[model samples]
Target chain A: MICNFGAGPCILPQEVFKQASQAVLNFNDTGLSILEISHRAPEFEAVVDETIKLVKELLNVPEGYSVLLLQGGASTQFSMVPMNLLAEGQSAAYLDSGAWASKALKEAKLFGEVKVVASSKESNYTFIPKDYEIPADAAYFHYTSNNTIFGTELFETPKTSVPVVCDMSSDIFSREINVSDFGIIYAGAQKNMGPAGVTLVIIKDELLGKSGRKLPSMLDYKIHADNKSLYNTPPVFSIYVSMLNLQWLKSKGGVAAIEQENIAKAAALYEEIDRNPLFKSPCAVEDRSRMNICFVMENKELEKPFLKLAEERGMVGIKGHRSVGGFRASIYNALPITAIHSLIDVMQEFAETVK
Target chain B: MICNFGAGPCILPQEVFKQASQAVLNFNDTGLSILEISHRAPEFEAVVDETIKLVKELLNVPEGYSVLLLQGGASTQFSMVPMNLLAEGQSAAYLDSGAWASKALKEAKLFGEVKVVASSKESNYTFIPKDYEIPADAAYFHYTSNNTIFGTELFETPKTSVPVVCDMSSDIFSREINVSDFGIIYAGAQKNMGPAGVTLVIIKDELLGKSGRKLPSMLDYKIHADNKSLYNTPPVFSIYVSMLNLQWLKSKGGVAAIEQENIAKAAALYEEIDRNPLFKSPCAVEDRSRMNICFVMENKELEKPFLKLAEERGMVGIKGHRSVGGFRASIYNALPITAIHSLIDVMQEFAETVK
Candidate 1:
């Protein structure tokens, strides 16, 4: 089996994949493909309800938070969050650490004023900026929890008086966090949840209805929250797959258990990168992502040979982003520790050859 | 096997389901689920490219038109169409025959002036309004080609002076239409394409860049067309399934052949509805949709019994929309002729019992 490490639209549990595939063929033996069923049907409603329940149970979401299954990905959420929260003439604070954060901030600027509280662009986003002050009058403090491209993560949730809005697209459910600390937490399902169609938005109920702008029905968070994300047809198959994946997570003792596994996996790879003579990890040691582990060869020429070796050894999606040409092994929730061991073995062999 | 007749997220060909299910387990033996592959990867880029090509081929999309695979469903397009097309002080004309058209007009009003050219709501949307004049100075004339809820369709494309935009969500590929007639034709993929996560937008290339409004990148059609819908992570699995469905359509002799089959299925059901003494077709015969066949028992009390009978006979999703509830049998491009025959038989049996 190929060890796929492509960031976002990354790997899923084999059992979840199998169950999802079966549902596609014949959902619950109704002889109807999951693709053919209406979202309004009880079967689909059950999936949505169960998914929300499981999300709450797994995340230990406190009572006042609402979970919504939405579409258009986290990129759309970048615009939606600002459109729904930042009022006219008001500003929101953003902590920019990577490409996605920069994009979110840029989209937010179209809706209202934005204050860059902190950014790591000066260091090419190798670390999450620390020791920055959030604006006192800001509507919300927006931050990305993990940087997929730069392979850095904010280990500590920023302490802000303003409502905290986070784009946890790459690392949600891979670790445990206090849901009560944030006003809004959104994640595209492709990374840790399930697939690429639906986005999961968990927001505090009271934070909504504050944006006074005339918003479209689809863009309005209150409408979706009131209607329970059934305002329009949802991404049914995507939500169903996400539900299955969440069930798998629950079976594995939920997020706390998975977080431990993730920590171990990240530790194994990061340890290898630090020890291997021919390689080096570019991310700040303290802020290295447990989800996306990025490293590079000491010599630029060795990059091509190492990539080819990894590919030959059944490692897929190890190539890094085009802007930063090196390597990124994204070990999501579904990726096993054994896969990391296999990747390290390949890295060690390549180092020996280069030596 | 049960016959599915839900309006959208409706039935797909068994062959397409088999292929899609296999892809979900392992896409093309790549040892990775389609859900796991990056949107930019060649594997998924190929799916997007092929789906676009098939959409063009099936619809006979004319030159100077761009087809985009977008997320957020057609409801989002209701807002996006106005955001991108209707500028300041500009009024757009809308022909409101049913719920969806009225929704589009409602969203358009959020952006600029909207002139209701005509509406069939007085007759409870049982007929399409034909003799309305398109406002000469209107930015664009918008109408839904087929009303899924009301079971009405505009059989003839309206000739308008302004740019003509049509939401063909229900009847997109079920028949042939002249592509040159429309400035924009948008459809939710759930009904006639594959599933519920993606939307298909066909816009004239020249019509873009005239909105004069700064739009969010995700909400802007021009940006998506320019980026080939890869501006952000797309609903990869949804798009992939849609591609497989389009391929199934092509294998069944493209839209031309599928149109003939669709015609036969609708005719068989309509013929049965007319002859059966216990039932009546409520939609105007001239405007009655071939995609969604709406009929009801002459006696309202018989509705529940007939629905139960259909359900018992291994038929699913035969219940009509809650707004005009009796029964709605949605026979899209993928529904088999045999399924309709079984429905007719069921109707005949119900008539005998009532008589």
Candidate 2:
């Protein structure tokens, strides 16, 4: 009955958990735990195949793109993006929207020059900076499509002629995007995907091998793409559970259907936060994230009592990121509308008690 | 009842699987699936702490060494090892005993100069190379402790003045080792540990950052060790299950007790492989891997029929690596001695029928 809603590595569908547990006992009745099975086994290859196909189908990825399920999370992708795309002496443009965004740009700086085209760091990243331009000479334009820490999301792909790379760790599957618009899209699997071990990378095939640097085999996207993400052992259980989760998503009618539900849950919760005298959202209205609904208490002294009552009512993992002291109702794809309603009830009860 | 002899992601204690399955349902009665809990959560952090402690306890890791559970497997370490230790204009010496050993050298070449002190490649890597002299002037001496594919293993650390780095992916934890003898010891978790997603790295703290290379954060061992593998979202499920597996190992009397069991199982299996006239080991006797017991048919024509019968008798993954092309009974730690007996029975039955 606990409405668990922590950030990345957050809630997955109950069915996925059940199926994953069953697989641990016996994967596809192979008489072996999914964990104990070899990655090269035909059964596992099929799982990888289906998982990749599901990602491509859900994202409507174009022919020229390769979708990879890799390890090391989005943090690894931070350096890998520039290692493959930004050639020596070339600079990459970045939109630093939050902590993760700043971290991404910082890693990019190690490989080559980085230009901060826009950043809301001065305002403590409460809003996504909009009034900035992607330098025409920059090698690529990078942005955080959704800043989980700041509760902000960039809805529109910036108007840039150059290729774009995005960190969509929090919002990849909650809504559909034009896959062809970006040269590279990487997200850690902990959020909308499945778990923390694997990451999803969608790369425009042509964008690889352009970097003048001699990259290590693991960091080379072309090597992974050419090998179909089987360049190494891969995070097998993570990918298998992700495959199950994606299948669940497909059964619930894929990304488009999930988007409608996500929007509804966010709209309801945001409305409640705005309506309740005790609560207020910390994000800009136009840029607020649909997945991670970050909010704060209007009265500072009420925060602890509100959290305690919510906990007593079985609301878990509502604590926000330390960077921003508040509550974050992460209504990711797996969170049902019922959890949102329960949260609203808690908020209303708290408001009445305070009055 | 099924005997899975796959080389890696091979086998683990049954209780670990059951517990892992239950955790997927609800981790520690937190009313949250382990897959859904945030990595930053106190419960997950405790899991990480205990896992690191378990590694140090099981391996008897000495002072000045760091034990880290990382993602990307040993293949990632193939590069990270060189990237962290091989300084510019310096050369690293490698002992090329098998395919994996050769691949490690190739990756080292990407970082700086790699000196292959000796290679058994001409013999199809059927034996561990022994007569090589590691250059004192080299950055460090590198070697693969166990060659999973070719069924060769280096049991004794080579006498080298330079820091010795070993990729013990296949044989770590199967036997006791002096941790102070090497600069680094790394192993992928799939074999003797838990599953495929996480890797174990034990580093002698002083050897890192000597490469003088500004490594990408993920590739740098110091960053991971300093952060205790929490620099980013770790492969949480893999690490968690590894902790459970390590606990199971400890309950079974830790590595010393398991070593005896492993030796007994390996001795019995090797005895059967040697006794059955139809089959003979392809690897050198002195260098034969106790973990992956590779043997080929004495009469090549009997190979297919023997494998078919073995499969019918529930002997799975006994097929040798394609390079060796006969059979490999990978008797990893969690594989009971009973499975070894079952394999011997299959071999005897096949031999009697052919006679």
Candidate 3:
């Protein structure tokens, strides 16, 4: 069996793919592809409604939170979150953990005063900074829950007086969390949810209409909140597939059940890296991400051959990012435990042969 | 046969839909669904490469024009185009024709001095203004190629010394034209290309870098152009399906052949509306859009029965925009001539019964 470790736009639930394929040919017996349906039509509306409802139910989001399936990736929300909430002089605090988190901090700065309360850059982003105090007067405390490229995660959120905001792009739905702790939680659908094209932004309704900044129609959360995601045409096919994936998550006993499986898969891979002499993980032990695993060899010459052997065994997409070159294996929400074991087996055999 | 007239996220060719369905299940036999592939990987890189190539071949876009498949829809570009190209002191010419056109004008005003060269607001935007002078010193002449809500089109582009920028959101690839004439052409894919979430921007390479503005990474056209739409994680599935639609357009004899069919379909429906006293075309004779035909009854009371009968007969999404309070039949590229005939026959029968 081939194991896919592609970082984002990685693996999806098999059943979601099956249902998505069926819907493409005929949706709701309408004799039309889901791609061909109008968002304003009732058929497409049902897809949007159910997807939002499932997201709220699965996350156990509070009564006042409004979920929006928007276009662009989480990068767009980096600008939009501030544009809709932060006024000219008001400040927001952001934690810089990795590339994506830093990019969000920079984009948010364009709209208002963005204070970087904590940063992990000094350690090459191998560790998450702790004990940084979030300002009480800041509008929100922005953080990235997981960093895909660097293989790091913020295990525990900072104690902040302001409302918490998170970009849970890489590790959403992989663990249990109290949804009410966040004022906003945004995620790009490409990582763990469904396909690319949609960004899920869940926001507390009371937190909105306070910025007093006149935002463009597309950036205005109230417009999307009032329209129920139908103010304009939405990504119909992507949202439909996301709903299917959520149903698969539900069938598998929701977040609590998946969290246990994720822990097992991550532990198996990390254990091999720790015990094996040839490989060494790059991230700090406490901050290592459950989703992405980054590792390197004591002797750099073995990296290429190790990757070649893994490919021969039908293990793919393990090359690390150019920015931080080595090897990476992303075991996202849909990555089976069998795949992780197969990868570990390959790694052990490759290390033995090289030695 | 069901006649789909829903405005956007609308109809696509059956062949395109079929191919898209196959790719979603098994993309190029990678043993993974298309939704599960990484944008940075070679498999999806090829998809993006071939898509840009096909767009150039179909449009006859000039040598220097770079095609970018971006997210956030045409609404985002309404602000980004000006943000990237228009400097604070330099002015841009805008033609206000409809709701979207006016919105574009408003966004441009936020970036630079906006010159309203022409407007059809006097007639409630039922006609396109003529003989307006485009400023020679303006950065670009911006206009909406086809107004979806108002059902007006610029049959012939205006001559301007400055670069011509167009928002072809509703009518791109529905007809043929010289792509070289415009400095930039942008379209939200929901209308004629693919689904929502992906926006196509074809920009002249030299026209950029003149604004000297510190654009955020997401809004900078130069960044995406340099990286070949990989400046960030793109909307992958939406872009892949767009490639299928473009391929379908090529197989069915490209834009020139489809333009002939489009003209015929528009003529057939408009002829019926003009000849019958019970119904009347709302747009001016010289400004009618070939893609979207807006019509109303001589007596407004007949609108309800017409919509009801049409919906019952599987002729869906025919009610006009709420702003206009009439009826609109959007005969886009994927709309077959048979559907137009069905609508025309219904119009004749309605006139006989209602009169």
Candidate 4:
């Protein structure tokens, strides 16, 4: 009956964890731990091959797109995307929605000119900025798909003639999206995937080799795509567990089915926040994150009892980010609908006591 | 009973795998899976803090040295080391030993001037080149500690007047050495540490901030060191298992005790190859890699059977690199002494059958 609501390095399905643990002992009856196998071996190659294939299938990537299971997290991609795409005198359009988007734009500025098309910083990231212009001649339009700390998201991406790059670290695989709309989509494998060692990058093959910059082989997607994700020592265990999580997604009828459940879970929690007079959600209603639901109590005195009551009832990791006070409930793909019900019940009890 | 001899991501102790599996299920009795916990939570932070402390103790790193668990493998460090240390006009000395060392050199060359102090490529990397002059004013002397494919190692590092930066990907913690001799040492976690998602970087604090170049945040060691390896989402599962492996090392009398056993194992396998007329060791005796022993069959026709027989006898993953074109027995830190004996026995049987 224990519920976990920690964000990124967040909750994974019990079954995925179980299978991953077993693989460390005996992988595919090869009698060797998955960690011990070389990437060049057929068995290990199969994992890489199948992982890419599954990722492509899940994302509905187009024919010219290549999926890479790379080392480093989304922070790495913030620099690599610019290193591979941007050139001198070419500007990239960046939407600063939160901390992550700000960091991405800062790194991009070091390489080339960056235009802040829009920003939510003025509102302390409590609302997503809607009005922005993307230049047609810009290298690309970059945006953060989901803001973990601010608990905000863009329900619909901006319409831009240029290529779009999104960092979907907090809410990848939780909803359905047309992969063809974006030129590149990258996510760190902590939330909704498995753990925090691998970053999944889906890039359009045609977009590469245009920057003319001498990029490091490790950061270049073209080199990795040419080598089939075997150019370097990959994050093996993280990629393996990610495959298991993807398999679990497929078994539950893919993102389409999971998206419906995610909608219901988020609705249940948001409903409680709206009904309780003592609690208020921070993010603008139109831009609220479905994955991470954040709220603060009107009376700060009641916050302590709310957290302690939830913990005593066996719910864990319900605390919010340090910069953003109050509580956060992270409902990733692996979090079940029943867990949301438990949190709703706890909230209702606290509401009566506060009054 | 299966013996894994793949270079790395290499074998780990069975006990470590088991205990780590338990952590994934219920970490510290928090009723939450380790994969589900937030990084800022006290429970998860404790794991990160303790793991860093354990690494410092095991290596006997000086007070000024900072240890960081980073994402990306050794290949990532190739660019990162120079990006943070080599200023625009500064020069660095590189030793060209094999494919990996050459790749490191190529990455650094893009950053600043580089001097090829020595090269073993002329001999097909069968011997380590000696009598090379290092630049007195160079920013650092860079070298790969062990060549996994070529089976050649620098038994003793050069006494450089400049600071030393080493890529110890294949043979870290396999033997004992003074930790303070080098300014910086990095190893991919797949070989001697844990799995393939994390890299351990140990650097002297004073040597940082020398490079005036604006390094990308993710590739900057000071960024992770300043945050205690929490700058972004780190490779959690890979590092947690690495902690268990390090704990296992400490319980078994640390690196010194393991080095003795590794030495004995390598001696036994090499003795068998040298005494048997049917086999020939590839590298010179003085520069042979204790971690990866490469040997060739005297009769070219026997190569197929030797590999097939070894596989059938449950001695798995002993195939050599395609570039080397011989059998390589990788006796890493976790590879048992019994596994090396089994390989020796296989070699004896093959020799008798050929006669």
Q: Candidate 2 lDDT, tens digit per residue, B140-167?
A: 9999999999988888999889999999
lDDT of 3 by residue, B131-230 (tens): 8899999999999999999899987878888999999999999888799899999999988888777899999999776689876677789989999998
User: Can you write out model 1's per-residue Cα lDDT over A16-134, one digit (the tens) per residue?
Assistant: 98999999888987778899988988888999999999999999999999999999999999999998998899999999899999999999999899999888898889899999999
Candidate 1 runs further than 4 Å off: none
Of 2 and 4, the candidate ranking higher by TM-score: 2
- The interface root-mean-square deviations, each candidate in sequence, come to 0.7, 0.8, 1.4, 1.1
TM-score of chain A of 1: 0.99
The two-chain DockQ for each candidate, comma-separated, is 0.87, 0.87, 0.69, 0.79
Would you estimate the TM-scores of all the predictions?
0.99, 0.99, 0.95, 0.98
lDDT of 3: 0.88
User: Model 4, A1-355: lDDT tens per residue?
Assistant: 8888878788888998888878888888888777777877788888888888888887787899989889878999999999999987899999999999999999999899999988979888998888778889999999998998889988687899999999998888899888889888999989987687888999988887768899888988899989998998888878888899999998998988898999999998999899888889999999999999999989888889999999987777778787688999999999998999999889888777766
Candidate 3 falls in which docking quality class? medium
> lDDT tens string, model 4, B62-108?
79999999987888899988898899899999999988899899999
- Highest lDDT against the true fold, candidate: 1
Query: Any runs in candidate 4 off by more than 4 Å, and if so which?
Result: none
**lDDT score, candidate 4, position A283:** 91
The CA lDDT at A85 in model 4 is 93
